[model samples]
Target: MVDFFTPDQIAMLSASTVRCDFLVKFEFASSTMRAWNGNTELVVAGDTYLPMFGFGQIDGLGMSGGTVSENVTLSLSGLPGQALDLLSVALDDTPEVDQQMLTIFLQLFTDEWQPAGTPIPIFRGFMQPPSVSRSAMQGTEGATQSISLTAENIFYSRSRPAYGRNTDRDQQARSPGDKFFGFVASLISKTITYPDY
Candidate 1:
């Protein structure tokens, strides 16, 4: 009979190293739907970290068999008006503007000997436009307004990340075609074309 746990599995479970830090980057959609060939790093002034963040596993569906989708929730504290303006451009009310998407990259690093060791990407995917909300509470001390961004992963695959437009070259290169762009384009086109024809 085969053993329940393998040597590699035991070693991995008993590993002492723990993840200590994380790095997150966001890429907002641009004017054109062609493809993203530019840098995706978000530029912020001074030091700023997402106060609250969570990604992966959609509740009860965690153990389900079908295609699994993930979600990301980010809370930004003391967000400046300038940053909000930039985000507004990406996530707006108009149909054309709302089509814009966000690419989020999250990297996790283990508590190893090296201070600058390479980080492993834990989650990376194109997220639907965030549902943003601003809340202000008045207290005895003062009032605070915080902004929260919640988005769902557009594609389900963990190994393959979905970003950029689907090109003819990309379609021909991969057997299954680009998962992210392919699925989205088909869904959107179907919605738009169904009523027209």
Candidate 2:
């Protein structure tokens, strides 16, 4: 009998590391989206913050069974809408912003870690700040809003993760590592509530 347990356990252990990397990537992408979306409030030093009144994290899981897949839908009715045509997320510099994004990603990874244990490092990957486009919207009441655009078939995937060794591992572990990745990815589905500034 091929121990599905053994491979699954090792995969979970190795995935702990990979999970951290995945979360980091998701966080970076989220921050870039918010910054480039142009709805964030710019602070005194030009740093932007998610608008306080409308900011919230959308937490959920996505799953695929064979060719069919499902993800939780989030409501973005509380967030401010976009204005800029194409926001540039400067990735050429390694500054506090980049470090903050990394730290945030790690925190998010741990927070979403399922079948929770000590957080472990599992994989490594990076993405270029993607090419951006924008879409404009108009309300019947004469309001204007914009959205950062996405194209069809723009698929991207990171290296698969292998998790850390599970010591005193429970045979009935109810959670899977893929859920962590799905949750992080769902952050990209942010919507705008107030579009016109």
Candidate 3:
């Protein structure tokens, strides 16, 4: 619902010639992979995004019924042999909560292939588990592999509990020395009645 475009990015939108690229950052356990659905590698904010045609498409980002979806689906594909190595990352998500998955909209100027302005982050969320699939072509000698990653919006966490208890013991477990909630538990069963005037 909120517009995240800068002045320059806004101006670039209504220009005569507008070109845009999508940059996807996948933060994994061992390494962070930066990829762009572009013809060539691009460097934005000093970070290089590898050219990857496998960033097939992104869905669930559009508004529906005045609200955005909680999860966005990212489709990626490559040779069956490589599979973009995303399958491993997907499988690694079991023991840990996957890190932030960022997707930015990079506006490119057609004249010299330079950026119009600072890129705008279109999708910011943590990636859930991914689903991988493989299929063979009718006449091709090799097969293609694809993975669908569901990126759960960060706002979805607001509906979940933080697991914090309003007790001195619980507070001490977290801070070890802080007793901010020390009196909260004792006050639960004690009721102070007001005297009649």
Candidate 4:
């Protein structure tokens, strides 16, 4: 295996007191949204990462034998709007999860909370329909809402993700100008020649 972490990032990780954050990105219906575990806003790669105190933490993020586990579970509990809009979409499209993708990025930070380097994409997977739990306001505690879900890893047990199509339309959906699949439509109808040896 090759070392992919930068020296600065390595140094940050090896520091006596280290600060780090996990940046989470959710892509659905061709839209991208970002959030981070830190308590403050951050700008990385020209994209703003808002604090996701609601994203309390993630479980089962480690890798073994160079392969990710089949599934990881995470929960997000927050009152801030928009960061949790993915929840609404999940509820509305309960049966259409193949079109959505969830990615986790690792970003190392200095003692001052400044980013050490660009966030590195560490995990890619699909988030299952989450179970939402809401609490009614009573006494001093404010109303609370939280979502919990299992994320199936894209690289599980040496298998590819099941959400894929080889059609031209699928290619166009991801990249309109990409014509690699332009000939796929014709190949199926074209005759093939075989040499006799």
Candidate 5:
């Protein structure tokens, strides 16, 4: 059996393209921009936590336990133009064959839709370097060995949580996009500070 978490070992996998439905959910809950790249530091993307609660001897006394949630980390880097080429070189993949799907919208183009909905498709394609086969080479003395190729899925997204009593809906209902947007618009809307390259 193979241990998936040990990425340092011998084989190098590739992720040439990804196709999917809905949006590829990130921490900011936004789509990826094409022309962004750099050696950016890792940041907490998002979290999905399940709160634990236990009942005490008294009916009203409920003790709150620890929270369990999956945390995601995102490290954005590299210029858009060089991303595919760089990733291919670093991952030992075929740059010529990999199209490098960058946006969630682009993924929808790859599918064959049905009447209701389509399958949630994700992909990882790679061109592996050739390994010399001693037994096979003996039979065909003149021909050279061919490189091994492989592709597989590595990551997947999970469903978001349902709304409850303590949900953000109450806050939104009260303000209706008024709080932060109004505050920022009044304070710093006129500022045109340039971004650091």
Candidate 6:
């Protein structure tokens, strides 16, 4: 029962001339990844504020005609060394527990400068491990690096609900059990016997 969009915001978004700005925030818990510090400002390599190039729509794909998977990809340009290092940690296969993952929140604003009202929380999830890449050209243009990170929401891990009967248990039998594996086993045992037509 959470309200993601308000009436006024929805109306403004439907307008063709509405202007929106992007704000990115990174949340991490590690001494090496102390650059962001829960700040709303988008800072890279400790000194630069790189702007986002664009973002992919939050796509949902139906799995098995029941469960739906959702994810979004965000692209950033001119990422600094610090940001790259942070991404590297996430991409590592055997990183420390504290540096294993990081949560990234993206917000959209209707105004470009101050006096801007509270932005809308368009996306909030953990950044998928990504491999960083850089490109350089010999022309007059300098070198630039772009980073893209995809995040999966809660629905990405959800599956279709199981249909079955529940077993009654007393307080003495209410012990902890493997809910996930147990549920899967139960579903597999309930084989439907269709009429022999």
In model 4, what lDDT does residue 71 have?
Answer: 73
Candidate 4 has an lDDT of 0.71
Q: Mind giving the per-residue lDDT tens digits that candidate 1 earns over 168-191?
A: 345546645444444543442142
Q: Pick the candidate with the highest lDDT.
A: 4
lDDT winner between candidates 2 and 4: 4
Cα lDDT listed for each candidate: 0.39, 0.29, 0.65, 0.71, 0.25, 0.44
lDDT of 4 at 131: 82
From the highest TM-score down, the ranking of the candidates is 4, 3, 6, 1, 2, 5
lDDT of 2 at 120: 26
Sorted on lDDT, best first, the list reads: 4, 3, 6, 1, 2, 5
Candidate 4 ranges beyond 4 A from true positions = 66-69, 78-84, 95-99, 135-143, 156-197
Instruction: Write candidate 4's Cα lDDT for 1-197 as tens digits.
Output: 33577787778777788777788887765567777776677898888887775456688887543333477777777647555465676567665444367889988876676777889887888877778888799899898887776778876445444425555666787788788876764563255666636
Clashing pairs for predicted structure model 6, backbone only = none
The segments of candidate 3 whose C-alpha lies over 4 angstroms from its true place after superposition are 1-4, 64-69, 79-85, 92-100, 160-197
Residue-pair clashes, model 2:
14
What residue runs in model 1 are displaced by over 4 Å at the alpha carbon?
1-19, 30-66, 79-116, 154-197
| TM-score, every prediction | 0.39, 0.22, 0.64, 0.66, 0.16, 0.45
- Residue-level lDDT tens digits of model 3 in 1-197: 33467666777787987877667777765677777666667777788777665546788775332112377888877733342455666666643325455454555565677766666676678777677888777685667678787887766555423426455666687788897876664553365666847
Alpha carbon lDDT of residue 171, candidate 3?
A: 66
User: RMSD, model 6, all Cα superposed?
Assistant: 12.6
**Cand. 3 TM to true fold:** 0.64
lDDT of 6 at 96: 33
